[model samples]
Target: MKPVITVREYARLTTDKITEPTLDLAQVSVSAFDWLCKLNATFSNAGAALVQLENRCLLKLDNYVGVLETPCGTRLEILPKHFEREDCIKQSRVLLRRMIQVSLDLPTREVGAADLQNFDAPLSEWVMGRFLLALDHLIKRGLRFDYQRVEEEQRFLRGQLDGVKQMRQPPGRQHHFQIRHDIYLPDRPENRLLKFALDEVCKATKDAGNWRLAHELRRVLLEVPRSRNVQQDFNQWSSERLMAHYVPVKPWCELIIKQKIPLAVAGEWHGMSLLFPMEKLFERYVAASLDKDLLQDARLKTQAHTEYLCQHKGKNFFQLRPDLMVLHQNKSWVLDTKWKRLNSSGEDKSYGLKQSDFYQLFAYGHKYLAGEGELVLVYPRRSAFDAPLQVFEFAPELKLWVLPFDMERGVLLGAPEGFPLHSQQLQSSEQSA
Candidate 1:
């Protein structure tokens, strides 16, 4: 049986030959391992492995499960656990789907029962499955292939020959006349890249012993031309062209173009492992959720950039980009999401809230919220810090709220649970507005 180990970011694990042994990664997974190493993961000299998941990557691995396949056909499953098992997995799925939509710039779709059925499946399988479904849909609508002009020399005339060029080259001594003709072809860079990605996913599915998914991917790959030198040629296409022609596959294509995921190559194993910064994800989730649930007439802006923190020699520097800014009735509320776990025992010490964070929010409070409005620091609700602590007295006018954003509930708890100031101030601000 394959060994399953649970870990989190910066978690270290020593290989025990007796109980759990070190993995001899398969070529494909080795390539995936290389990708991880490029990120924050490290392998020790003592056959131990350490995965230091940064905010971005942890966000990317929504399910927080990584499957490493070995050359010996054995598998090592690494599940990063930070919260309760079920809650963590559920949260991961939600984040993963959101990340996919954001990366693709696609609209968020409701998660159906069918999608949740595969909640326990490997993340790669789900991603590839979604990709395949999209690809298949595009194929049904007729794969977008452009009529690219090709110019080549041939002994025999193929199309309308270039008389000027033919004259310059003259007739070959062995073959006779050489002709250059412009021929329209379907084998373009965009198509090739898509084909390459499909093939890569297919191989990964096969390696995972997921024949069902592999079969579907193979069927789709059959329709696309076997792309060669895709990595070298993929960058030539512009985003505009991709959106216009390859609308269905545009997101996946962008994933490859941006190197957010891995491109498959023949003779070498390659896979994609995505990571998301928890800070950004938390901020986005809060901003989006608040916009939908909390504010009615107010405008919500994320990473709202309005002013520079300071000016030097007539030069503006240090731009103030608040995570979430809510504007209502001529008043702005600046809220920043922090992914740190608050400790109740350290209440005297700001509940493990860094002094720098407080200073940062102070700047936001003064500059963006005009000192009188609510300046909030949001954190995930933990058992220790389930409720919002007392508001910080940054100044007489400015108030700093330490609130808990309930991950499981997907809402900002109020008062003793969260920050009471949030709802109260918003209501007061709205009544005045």
Candidate 2:
């Protein structure tokens, strides 16, 4: 049976995340340690550090205070991945939610420089991460730069023709300069990888402190600029230009601030990272889909999420506005979005499930039951084509599938809850890596 874990417990375990990072200086059984590392378990990658003397180690595990260890004479550089650990993934999620909310609460007027710093930076980072993913997705699918404007430059080579009218160099205000390196998009992977690679390049670049990120990239190749984190600064610096090209994210913000629910804007509000790069389990993931549904039915797709409620509540009162609910062929089913984790064996995760979750679904089943009222818990997956999907039966003829949203790291894997794979599925790195 899959272990059931609670969201409350996950938060409790996450409080000490990033607080402890350790290095161990001790003599331990090398074979024992190696075995752990092989399981994607935490082990000292730098085991040789503690060969002779004790060293300082940062312990990041939950409720565990920092410790100094000298096992024997060898040193160990170990990191923990377990129930209690400071994970970057968790931190990113929390920051993203808060930043989105904060941005929504601000006045509709142009968010000022102060606003950009106080709120936009964090939100900008989240958007940037999403943008990075989108850019990655399109690039992998053979997308290129939108449009490039190039002009022919005929170089005036010296001595091309004997006695060609010689013109003396006149010193004047230099209005323009030409770039040397031919700027052309590389092949697919290279183009898709450029953003991520550029991020790394910007970090190491001596003039990174001088780099900026306005709507368009402008290079001051003539005189290199200083370096610092300037992506947001660039965006704001070129706000005038940006406004001319890109519409403000107002309607989207109003839904969250005024409505507390960020709705879709022209069906482009919610961008799917899906399995192409990550999971689309958040309520925001369906913003675009909801907008379309609402447009068609005029009243449908309006559901509960903090300040709102869906169709009806059951006797047990487990409230849930499913990711999607539609009446089809005189019947309706509730589709719920779920993010999943795995164990070393690549099987369904029982670790993160909470008992309350089952009850909530039970309520949905009771209230939304039609025929064998269907309820699907959707998850992001690699290649569903490689493995057989495991299903659980809630009742006789009543099925609930913990299905996969088949999206590759960059390509569209499949669809929501639609496992587009055969029974012979291959295990993923979620277990072995």
Candidate 3:
């Protein structure tokens, strides 16, 4: 069975085939229903499960894909938008590669067996499969396990006795001492956490009927000890060690660590979810793309915090951090990327531009660029707004350009017209003057 299905089709599938139709959850697979319930519980408002259409469930998703699994071994992948699979995979790879570089300070390796170019799979499957492949590779190369000192409270009269005499039970009962043993053990918190995550992933994959991925994950999990303490306890050194040996898995590890919860509902673990906030992903992709495509002399900064828009009594507050800032010789361009759909109507709806966004951009222009230079609002190209909107002036001197970043090409659409002229021109004009 194809794991991925559109939300509309799913809703239809769960609905009764009658004139006055009602949703019947029984129509859908048990696993899918469980997955939806879990999503509702975990994500609440932000979850993909949007509303209940009678017994049918409606999902609210766009430009995103969710991988869901139930305890009964049902795997349901939901992708709301029908994006070009190759393009989506490529963009995802770009984002993950950049994340690994930023977080681990390591270069990305060849995707190798996990390459999504030829693979026709759902987004969730691809992501999980790629992660499993990376993880398996790292494990075969040897997991970065470190010897850690362990302390145990044991009932022994021979070993190192407690320094506190009162706690020694005064020679009446069996004297137990809390002995700190420096035994080199592989069951460190980091290893345990990794093991725990691996176990969860293995279960999820198995439930999803991804036998190959599950097998690989299980093989890795065998080496690491099952940890009762699923809490995150790794320090910077431990992370460095793990990333040093397996840099490609850094992003996956971070995601697992952040999302893994020990609580089990319905006798099955609520597996870790790898959700990429589209806003941040778009921002990162745009920044990385611009860094390469922009002029060599041009400097680009992501999440640049150079100024504060407001201040309290002797303290600074309400700082402005623009998504992307490009600085040239004598001028700077302040740009912010918004991951939202634009208005389709030809009428002047400002292309569904938010008033607060304009206000924010205006502040960025006034504060960051000294109320000069070009201020740009960047958004991903959608069906409604395919091309760059006309440039408008917030003030006579400050221009706000609304441009689209094309996902398929992985480049800013109409870049030449969207970006402002280099500051070198201004310098030449000034020199000539």
Candidate 4:
């Protein structure tokens, strides 16, 4: 197995092992490099958003963060941009797992950063371990048994005989009965799908613990055949009250079985890519945190589609969807989350804030808040950009608050007037400094 390479999103990749942040492509085997070249070629052809090949020997990762493996067992762990510092790689993984848990609403309990200090594995193996844990819990709780419909030709007639098949049988084969019967068994679609996930984990996991757990679970699920058609089995699955324990494990199954990621090059590369767009993940994590930590007696709406930019040909065009909208006491506040970092002391006084974002948020403010309410732009809290920037006032009644969402603490830090913020979440932005 090749040594696992860790890089933050947007890090440079070169052929020679030169420096700290830039991934030395030389560490990968020739086959793995060829596979990466093929992936880059495919992504270039399809206009994929995963990585960009700057030169023949260089690659630039886009705004995606996850674990991807090459066919030659070259594992690459792409972390969030906020984990730029060298000492924070483990911290990054922990927080990334937490973000995934919250955003995807995986039924796993809170896993603190300290809890995973010893388990230094990539996201893929960590996720596989979580799945195995859930599966083990489920097995201890007892697997669900259902009366599954089975069809077979047997010496003994059981349940209802297939009349057409029975008649179609040869005359000398009277002893064999073509029967369709309902048998109570644990080999149902859900279990079969889980078996399929277990097989995938066994094949793909690089961690020793995950591999061992996967093999153990595989033995337990030996009677349950692997899923032939995952989609078909999922279609057949039902969220009946009995399989509540399976809920936590189901997401892991889908994530592994489907290799849930936006990049399409995984199929051609014949490798595992469990990537998520940083912007989307950040947006969802912030929204979920707000809904959980605060927002009591209030409603938090995501992707609010209550307005459109303009009308053409008597039809609405460019529908405006703010990342989040908080409704409280018959009043509304609009908020948007940006995954980009900000700088306070730069040649540009805007603190790396994009003008286009302001324009977009300006439109959202006018449309969603009628140009009279507070708007917020949430960015991930980092070392350089720990404090919130001063508010931007578009008019006497309208203002914009650029706040830092502390990823480690899961708190939105800023003081925005008229915004419903709990004291615990309303720490002074400078305090983080």
Candidate 5:
């Protein structure tokens, strides 16, 4: 059996300790450590700083969380650092899946049934199961077909005759006619890409159920050929309004086909890195939640780049993109999410808030909100920082709110009095508008 170890974000794996694994620490053999070092090296070479190697034998995980499998069948599961409650691993795993689903714009109901049924499976297994579920959905909706042009020799010509090829036939093959024709078939680029993804997932999945499902789907797509060149197929893939159901499955297929680590180094380690940066995951999750929870009249925009921090001689430089921008009537609010946990202890009077963060938010307030509206720094709601802190005033008209977002409730907490939220203020604004 594979050695499955679970840890939280910012956890460490050490080769010096051979003791039992804990939530934040684990012991791996030298060989496993070498595999990790290779993995880190590959990530660095690909311009991604996902993990850091300490000393020589310690492998430290940064903010990237998910599953990392080694070539030797050692699996490292990293969960969110703040999920410290009972059964936190399971909770974090489910939450991570939801975040990925939201980020990919997949409906929660479509790919979550199998996930909920297999709660204790590894992250990789869950991912494979999700892909299989998506394939199943696509199969039920009916596989799409496209016209494939073919040139062949037959007893009778069906399409335009290939006179040049027919004239070159041997003496005994005078009856055979060379024809070029287009046939409506299921061997298009999209189905080929899906078939390739299914093949990759079949090899990577560890669950028997996933294997069986993949096999069934492969049988269903028997007419579709596996992609000979994935990149070429991707270039040829096109979206059609009629095949709208393909939207949710395409991302999963691409995710399965491409290694997340970003480098294709030649080595014995061919395992997949199904990791996601916590910052991006948190930002996208918060944006999606806010969009769903906000009133219809109020619109939320993500990563809006309508402003710049400064202007140069001939061009505008330092473009500012706030994570979440809420527009209600004539009012605009700029909210940026931080995946870092806040320190609520008295020893840290600043609540561990970075000075640079305030500067960033101040810049955003001046540019995005016209320097007079409310600016928010949203952090995950943990036990230490379950409520909003006191508001900071940059000026008489400019105020910055450091608020906590309740992950469980999917709501931002402790907005100041008279804030434009679900209260009468928002209602009145909508009414007035």
Candidate 6:
């Protein structure tokens, strides 16, 4: 027997990598908290909030970012002040690796800058995974959350998302799945009649082992049969000859028609799809939303102009890394994705301006020269600041953009405002960044 699979089961396992216990909201997912905390250390406020969300709450956000990228999808990167700090994992290198992979894999074949979408995956799962693994390399890394609390807490959040209760029955000896699907066929009146005629012709042809009969039957049903024999010119038919013609195959027509279908069938397969349309709508929404990130990801692989590299001379270092790198034609700029909060005003600012970020980008500008090229910093969208696209200058032409992201909405709208820069975009970028 096939093992039972439900949308609920898929969600639980994929979300938690576990089957039983489900998930709780109040206790917070330990894995989520740990991941967010570590993300905060490396990325920032975006990291901090991700953990808080894991605890359970009705949250909605929007964000966007613009960056100049390397061919391997490297965003222009700058190191934060607390580099290698105990709480932080060194993700800059791993992040750069993602940029590099995207740069090399681009369909355009450019060098210094490419979109992050290309590089974000392989690196996130592999390089980033290793980095996280190394972060846990310490003997002290222990559980920070309890599964029971999170499961119990999950109740409150269910009301906010659809299909949360499509839960599976407890696992048992009988493996099973809640099969769900839906189908839609053209609904036009003409289409319905055509479909009906086609079905009848096919049914008749099924008994005769002839496919040409089906084709001619289609024409005949539409009402145009010029002659009794297959050799007869269908062209000779008058206007009224077509519409409801259903000529069964003629013996002589078989001589002219050499091909036939061993089996004939008709009508849409509705059983599979009809079983579940609501579930399909939900599934479709998920797929559409997820794909938004893939298409809008601005991780671009762009190569510096020959002149830009030649100026660097000895350091023609075959490799360069930049996240959120922006480019127009051959001109380019760069930025990095940060998950941390941007605290402009506060007695104890959780995250303020990082001198190191300025210094790091300054070098990239000094070498890559953003004033000549350009550089920017991309961050997740948050409520801490309203209308959060702020610009800071390390150099005149080089700028930093604290873009917004809406993780739920995707880039289906022609040129959606954010550069993978919506709330959903913000979340996905920071997750990989």
lDDT of each: 0.56, 0.32, 0.57, 0.80, 0.80, 0.32
Residue-by-residue lDDT tens digits, candidate 3, 1-433: 4343323113343422234432211234545655655555654454443334344443333333344444444544433232324224344444443433332333346453344345555444554555566677777786555655555666763345556653655565545666654554556565576676566566555335455666766765675687674444444325454457655665555454553211112224564333444456567767766776676677898888979998899888899999988887787888899877686567656678899999999999999988877888888777777777788788888888888776644567644333433333443467699
**Among all windows of ten consecutive residues in candidate 5, which has the lowest summed lDDT?**
258-267
lDDT of 3 at 17: 26
Residue 240 CA displacement from its true place in model 6, Å: 45
What digit string (tens of lDDT, one per residue) describes model 5 on residues 70-91? Answer: 7777888888886766357777
RMSD of 1: 7.4
- Per TM-score, the best of the predicted structures is 4
Model 3 compared with the native: what TM-score?
Answer: 0.66
Those runs of model 1 whose alpha carbons end farther than 4 Å from true positions after fitting are 1-6, 17-82, 85-114, 152-159, 166-184, 206-245, 256-258, 261-271, 291-297, 304-320, 343-349, 383-387, 415-433
The predictions' CA RMSDs to the true structure, in order, are: 7.4, 19.0, 7.6, 3.3, 3.6, 28.7
lDDT per residue (tens digit) for residues 360-428 in model 4:
999998998888988899998877788878889999898899999999778887647556667444454
- Residue 7 C-alpha lDDT in model 4: 81
True-structure RMSD for candidate 3: 7.6
Screening candidate 4 with a backbone cut-off below 3 angstroms (N, C-alpha, C), the clashing residue pairs are none
- Model 3 clashing residue pairs (backbone): none
Model 1 residue 4 CA deviation (Å) reads 5.8
Over the full model, what C-alpha lDDT does candidate 5 score relative to the true structure?
0.80
- Tens-place lDDT per residue, model 1, 7-56, is 34333333222243222211123333345444323333333333443343
Q: Which stretches of candidate 2 lie over 4 Å from their true place?
A: 1-281, 286-318, 343-355, 382-388, 407-433
Indicate the residue-level lDDT of 223 in model 5: 83
Q: Against the hidden reference, what TM-scores do the models get? A: 0.68, 0.33, 0.66, 0.89, 0.88, 0.27
| Candidate ordering by TM-score (highest first) | 4, 5, 1, 3, 2, 6
